[model samples]
Target: MTSNGSIATTLAPTRETLSSSQLLSSSISSLNSSSTRQASSQISKIYRQASTLFLTRRLPESLSTILPVITSPAADDTNPDASPEPAPISRASRTTRIKVWSLYLTILNAIVELDPDEGKQAFGSKEWKGLVNKVRDGDVWEEVVKNGYGGVEGDVDSDVVINLATLLLAHARTQKVNQTRLESYLAASTNPSLDVSSRLSTPTATRPHSRSLSPVKGSGTDTPRDLNARVKILELYTLHVLLRNNEWDYAREFISISSVLDEERREAFLQALQSLQEEQMESERREKEERRYQEEQLKRDVEEARRRRIESEEREKREEEARNRRSEKGSEIDYGVEDSPPRPGSSKSRSSVKGGSVKGGRSLPSSSPTARSSVPAKNVKVPPSLLTRAGNVVMNVRKLVESMAGSFKTRPMLLMQMLGFIVGILVLLSRRDVKERVKSILGKGWGKVRQTAGMGVKVSYI
Candidate 1:
C-alpha cells in the first residue's frame, strides 16, 4: 500500500510542476494585477510631486549666491526728504535683475518631479496642472518684477509635450545616472519623430540589458561633449534614440566617451580612416615588391615547364607523322613493274607486222616503236626474296606458322617460304601489341580456319 501511494504521487503532477499552458495562464494573471497596481501608484505619486514642486516658486540654483546689501531702497517716492523703505527681501530673493533665472529653475524642478523614473517620487497621480501652475507662478514672479522677463526663451508656455518629455527623459535615466540620463530621456520623449502615445499604448522596442551612454575610443565611438558646448547634437540625438527606445546596451556604449570596441567594427573604421590618407607611399612600395616577387617566380616556373612540354610534344608529333608517312610510301611500291598496257593500236600494228614478215626471219616493216616493243607476254618474275618476305609476315601471325610449315613431309618449299615470311614481318611490326593481335588472329585450329570460307586470301602477293 505504501509503494502504491508512492507510484500514484509520482504519476500525478505536483501543483508546482504545472504544464506550460497552466503556467502561462497563471503568470499572465499575476503580471496584469501587478502592473495595474504599479501603474496606479505611479500616477498618484507623480501628481502629488508635481503639485508640491510647481507651487514652490524658487530661484535658479546658480544665482542662489547672495551679495551683501550695499544700499537701501529709497524711503519715499513722493517726498524729496525721505527715501522709500527698503524693499523687504530674503537673501535668496535678492536677485533684483536676474529674476528670469529663478523662474527657469522652478520650471526645471517641476519637470524633474513629474518624471517617476527619476530619483524623486511624487505622492499623487497624473497632475498635468502642476506643471502649468509652475509656469504661472514663474509668470507671476516676472510680473512682480514689473517686466515680462523671458526664461530660456521657450519656457514661458505650459507645453504638455515638453512636460511629458522631460518626465520621460528622467524615467529613462533613472535606471542609470539620474542627472545625466534625465536629459537623454527628455530628448527622446520630446522628439516629434517618436510618438509617445503610440509607444505607451503598444509594446515598445526592448531596451537592451545595458543602457549606458559612454563614448567609444579612438575607434570613432560617440564623441565627448563638454556639456556646455553646442556641438554634441548628433551624439545627443543618437543617445536620445537609444534611451527612448530603451536599447540600454547600445545607448550605454554611445555615451561612454571612452569605450573602444576592440572588434571588427573598429577595424572597419580604421580602414575607412586609412583610405582618406595618402602619405603611406611605403604601403604601395611594399605591395609593388610583393607583386614583383610573384611575377619573377611565375616567369621561372613558366620557363621550366614550357621548356619540357613544348619540346616533348614536338618530338612525339614528329615521330607519329613519320610513321604515317612511311606507311603511305609503302603503299606507293605497287605490284606491276610496267604499270600501263601498250596502246591497242600499237598492239594491232605489231600483230600485222609479224604476220607480214617472212616466216620467223624478218618483220614485214618496223612497226611503231611502242608496237614493236610489245613483245611476247613474258612471265612476271615472282622474286624468291619477295616470297620469303610474304612467308615471314604470315609466320608472325600465330595461326599461319603451321600453314607456313605445311604438312611436315608434304611441302618442304612451303616451310622454307613461311620461315622467310616470319623474318620479314619482324621488320614491320613496330609496336609490340601488334604482334599479339596478329598472333591471336592467326593462331587458330585448322578446323576453324578461314580457308573453308572463300573470303580468305589463299595466294600470297607481295
Candidate 2:
C-alpha cells in the first residue's frame, strides 16, 4: 500500500497541479491585457490633459504632463531611491502613441520659440537653455528616435517624421544632420527588405515587425492614406529640406526616380521645384542689392559727417586767425605810438614837459641825465611883462569864444537861450538906475584886482 501511494504520487497527475497551471497561464494573460488597457487609458488621459494645457498656452505645465508618456525610464530608475519609471510608449495604442509624441514635439517647439525672459520664467535658466539647445542642435531628433521609436529610425510615424523635420528646419543651426536623417529614413522606407508581395504571402505569426506596426497606419504605399503620407514626406524632403540644403540636382533626380509619383505629379513637382529655384534666386538678388544699398548709405553718412567736421574745424581756424591778426595789429599800433615822436600839442608832449626830457620832439625816460637837466629849477621865478600877460589873456578869451560858437552850431536852442540872456542883461543895464548900479559894481571889482596885482609884484621882487 505504501509503494502504490508513492508511485501514484510520483506518476499520476493531480487535479490541483493541472488546475493551478491553467489558472496561472490565464491569470498571466489577463494581467497583460489589463496592464495594456490601463496603459492605453493613462496615455490617452495624459495626452488630452497636455494638449489642453498646450492650447491654453500653459507650456511649462504641458511639458511636465507629457514628458513621462514619451520618455523611457532610466537604467538606474529601478532603485527604490530613484523616481518611478513611466509607462513605455510602445505599450500604448497606435493613436495614443502618436498623439503623445506629437504633443511632446509641439511643446518643445513652443518652448524653443518663447522669448528669453518668458522661457526663463517658465522654465529655469539652465532648463530653458537645455531645451533650446536640444532643438537647435538637432538632438531632439535623436531623442525622438531613441525614446519613441525604440531606436529604429524608419519605424518613426510618418506624421511624427514630418513634425521632426519641420522643427529642425525651423530651429536647427545646420541642415546637414537633418538631410542625412531624412535620406536614411527614405532609403530604409523605399528599399524595404521584404517587398509587399512577400509580406502578403508570409504568415502573420512569422512575419517580421515593420513600419506597418508603427504609430502610423501603414507603411510605404500599402494604402491610399499611406500613399498620401508618403507623398507629403517626399514633398518635405525634396522641396523644403533639400532646398534648404541647396541640393537642387539631387532633389530633381530624387523626384524623377520616385516610384510613388505618377507622370502628372512628377511634372507638377518639377515645375514647382523650378519655380521655387527662380523665386529663391530672385530673393537672393534682392537681398544682395539691399545690403549693397545699406553699405553705400552708411558710407555716405560717414563721409558727410567727416566733411562737416572738417568744415567746422576750418571755420574755427579762420576765426582764430582773424582774431590773432586783429590783436597783432592793435599791438603794433600801440608800439608805434610809444616809439614815435610826440606831436606838438598832444598829451604826450604835456606829460614830457612835466617829467621827461624832450629832444628832437621825442620823449625820454625821466631817469636819464638829459631829462633831469631839461626840468626847470623849483625855485626859479620869472615875472611876465604886462604886454605878455595881456596877450595871454586875449588868447584865452578868443579860445573861449571859438568854443561857444562851435557849441552854438550843434545846438541852435542853446545859442538862442544864451542870446536872450545877454539881451535881458543889456536891457536891464539900459535903465538909468541899472547903469549906475553896474558902473559901481565894476569900479569895486577893478579896485580889488589892482590890489591883488600889487601884492603879486611885491612877492616876485622878494
Candidate 3:
C-alpha cells in the first residue's frame, strides 16, 4: 500500500505541473490577441499573479511564467515567406511594458541575491543596457528637457521609469560602468526644465498625436497622484545618492521635492535645507565684514596722508621762521650798527633814522616796538592827494550807478525814468537854445546870491 501511495503522489505532481504550464501558455496567447483592451487586461492580470508568486518565494515559477509574457516571438529569418504578410507588431504599450520590466527586474534582483555569479553575468548582458534605455527612452528624456513634464506622453508612467532607472544606476555604480552616462540619466530625471503641468491642455491642433491615447473614465484623481508619486520617487532616489556620498548641500536642495516621501524623511530634508541656508547667510555676512574692514583700511590711509601733509607744512613753516631770524641777525652784523653804542640823548635820533631806513628798505614788515613807535608819524593827516581823491570820486560814482542799475533791473518804471533823463540831457546838449537858457538861469541865480551876500555883510558892519 505504501509503494502504491508514493507512485500515485509522484504522478499527481507531474499532472499539476502540466496544468500550470497550460495555464501560462493560455495567458500568453490572450495577451497577444488582436484586441488591444483584452490584451492589456490579460497583461495586468498576469503581472498581479506573477508578483504574488514572487512574494510567496516561488522564484523559479514566477520567472518562467512572466518571462514568456514579456518576450515576443523572434522573426523567422531562415524560413522566408514571399507571400503577403501583416505588418510586424509595434512595441508594447507603456502599461504593458512597465509590468514586464518590473517583473524581469524583480527576478534579476533575486538572481543577484541567490547567486552572485549569475547576477554579475545578467548585469553585464546586452539586455541590461537595452532595458535601461527603454525605461529612460531617449525621445522621452529629450521631450522632458524641451517641454518639461507636460511633454512626456500620457501613456508613460514616470514613476516606473524612474524606479527602473534607480536600479540601473545602482548596478552601474557598483560595477563602475561608465559613470558619466549614468550620471547624465539622473540629471535628466531631475532636470529643472521639468516644471510644466502634466495636463498640457493645449488646443487639439497643436497636438496631432494626442488622440491616440484613450481617456480613462475615472483616472482624474489618479493622474495627479501618479505625477506626484513620480516626482517624489525621483527626489528620494536623488537624495539617496547625494546623502550616501555625503553631499549635504546638494541633498538639501531637494527639500521641497522630498514632499512625496514620508513626513519623517521630509523633516530631515527640511532640516538639511535650513542648515545650508544658515551656512550661506554666514558666508555672506563674513563677506560683508571683509568689505567693511577694507573700507576702514582705506579711511585710515587717507587720514594718515592728511596728517603727514599737515606735519610737513608745520615743519616747513618752522624752518622758514628760523631762516628769517638768521637772515635778520646776519643783516644786523653786515650793517655793523651794534659796534657804535648810541649816546643816551642821541638814542631817539638814532632810532628815528633806523625807523626811516626800515620804512624805505626792502625788508619784511615787522611787529616790533620800534615799528609801533613810528606809526604815529605815518598816521598824521595830510591834504588828500589829487589822484587819490579823483579815484575815490570815480569809485563812488561807479558804485552809485551799479546800485541804480540793480534797483532798475526789476522795476520797469525806474528804467524808463533813467532813459528819459538821459534823453533830456542829450536834448539839452544838442539844442543851442536849451543850453543857453539853462546857462542864463544859472548865471542870474549866482549874481543874485552874490549881491544878497554883500548886502548882508554891509548891514552887519553898520
Best by lDDT: 2
Per-candidate Cα lDDT values, in order, are 0.42, 0.80, 0.56
Clashes of 3: 0
Clashes of 2: 0
Model 1 C-alpha lDDT per residue in residues 1-462, reported as the tens digit of each score: 999999888867764466765988677656654654553454344334433444563312211221112113444657877423321221111122223223334454555454443322332334434433433333322322222111111111222223333333443333233223334333432332333454335331111111121121111123333221112232333344344455545544443432333345345433533442323457678899999999999999999899989999999999999999998877775533234444556654456456554556755455444434445543578658988988878767866556544564587776678788998787667667988777676676444665655445544322
Candidate 3 runs further than 4 Å off: 1-34, 78-98, 117-156, 165-222, 245-247, 254-268, 272-462
lDDT of 3 by residue, 149-175 (tens): 223333334554454445545543331
RMSD of each: 32.4, 21.1, 25.7
* Residue 154 displacement (Å), model 2: 1.9
Measured with C-alpha atoms, the lDDT of residue 188 in candidate 3 is: 45
> Could you tell me the C-alpha RMSD of candidate 1 in Å?
32.4
Query: Candidate 1: which stretches are off by over 4 Å?
Result: 1-195, 201-265, 268-392, 395-462
Which portions of model 2 show Cα errors greater than 4 Å? 1-38, 74-87, 194-211, 214-219, 328-462
Ranking by TM-score: 2, 3, 1
TM-score to native of every candidate shown: 0.18, 0.57, 0.32
Residue 170 miss distance in model 1 (angstroms): 42
